[model samples]
Target: MIVRVIESDNELQQAFNVRMEVFVLEQKVSEDIEIDELEEEATHFIGYEDMTPIAASRLRFVEEYGKLERICILKDYRGKSHGKELIEAMEATISAKGYKKAKLNAQTHAEGFYQKLGYTTVSGEFLDAGIPHVTMIKEL
Candidate 1:
């Protein structure tokens, strides 16, 4: 998988499409909640296999950390390490931007995956977009 920082409207739309498939369609998250007001303020990323978008995520500087948000991989692409690649790319960008920490509200089912990537759960489970999630943080 090739992960790139989204730099064009077309690339951003591709990212949104992947998110729609994974989050809104498969997970049943509402479109209104999935695509929120923060879109304009976040730096988005899209991962591609050849020319096909497979994964998507976004980063926002919050306080002293880079906040990772809306991370997803298309259903067909799960378990292939594309998600990990996408995350590493985001983390690299966070560090490059001089942030010393990264944080995210990870869906409970995916908490273990984030742990293996060096994130530590810092908060109890909470509901977000009607799904269970916990806040996780990692030092860059």
Candidate 2:
């Protein structure tokens, strides 16, 4: 997988397409919530296998952390380490931007995955977009 920071409208759209498939369609997250106002302020990332978009995520500077959001992998591409690659790319970008830490509200089911990537749970479980999540953070 090749992960790239989205730099064009077309690339951003491709990232959105992957998010729509994994979040809105598969996870039943509302379209209104999946695509939100913070989009314009976030730096987006998209991963491709050859020319096919496989994963996507976004980062926003929030307080003292780089907030990771909208992370997803296409159904057909999950469990192949593409998700890890996408995250590492985002973390690299965050560090490059001078952030000392990274944060995310990870879906409960994916908490272990984030843990393996060096994130530690920072808050009790809470509901977001109708799904259970916990705030996690990692020092960059």
Candidate 3:
């Protein structure tokens, strides 16, 4: 398994497919917002298992708000290290971009994962894409 940032349309397509599988089909999130205006602008990271995309995320610098997002992973790949690898890649991308911190709105059930990766909960639980989530941040 090799994990890295998305650098081509092929990788980007794989990342999009992963998101569609998890968010749209498995989680039933709205397709309208799943691929929104922000996608084209956000930086993307992806993970491949034997050259097949299995996990991914997007990074967007919200200017004054900080670098936020990139929190999607494949269901079948979940208990493995793909999610963590994706986050680490995002952190590296943030650091390279000169961002002091990175943030993400994590699903409530996955709070522990982010926390383990050095993120701290900074917001109360809220519904996002029909699932409970909490905003979290971590220094780069």
Candidate 4:
């Protein structure tokens, strides 16, 4: 897997396509909700397999930490450790930007995965886009 920060509009579009497939199409998330205004302020990342995008995520600076958002791996790419790699790469990217901490609102079902990556749940269960989620944080 080749994961890198998306530096161009074309690359951003590729990442968006992957998120659309995983979130909008497969998970039935509303298209209106999946694409947000943060795209302009956040730094995006894309994971590619043999030159084709297979995963996507974004990081945005909050008050004192970087917020990880829109993490998605396509259905066909689900079983591997690509999602973990994506988060790791995102961490490296944000860390390079001088962030000492990272946070995310993880889907409840995926909380264990984030826990395995050293994130601790910091908030009680909540709903985002009608999906159960919990806020998690980790030190970079």
lDDT of each: 0.95, 0.94, 0.83, 0.94
**Candidate 1 RMSD computed on C-alpha atoms after optimal superposition onto the true structure:** 0.6
lDDT of 1: 0.95
lDDT of 2 by residue, 1-140 (tens): 99999999999999999999999999999999899999999999999998999899999999999999999999888899988898899899989988889999999999999999999999999999999999999998
Residues 1-140 of candidate 1: C-alpha lDDT, one tens digit per residue? 99999999999999999999989899999998899999999999999998999999999999999999999998888999998998999999999999999999999999999999999999999999899999999999
lDDT of 3 by residue, 19-123 (tens): 899899888998898888888888887788977788878888886334556467777778887788888887887888788888889999989988999999999
Worst 10 residues of 3 by lDDT: 63-72
**Candidate 2: which stretches are off by over 4 Å?**
none
Instruction: Give the top-scoring candidate (lDDT).
Output: 1
Which ten residues in a row are the worst by lDDT in model 4? 33-42
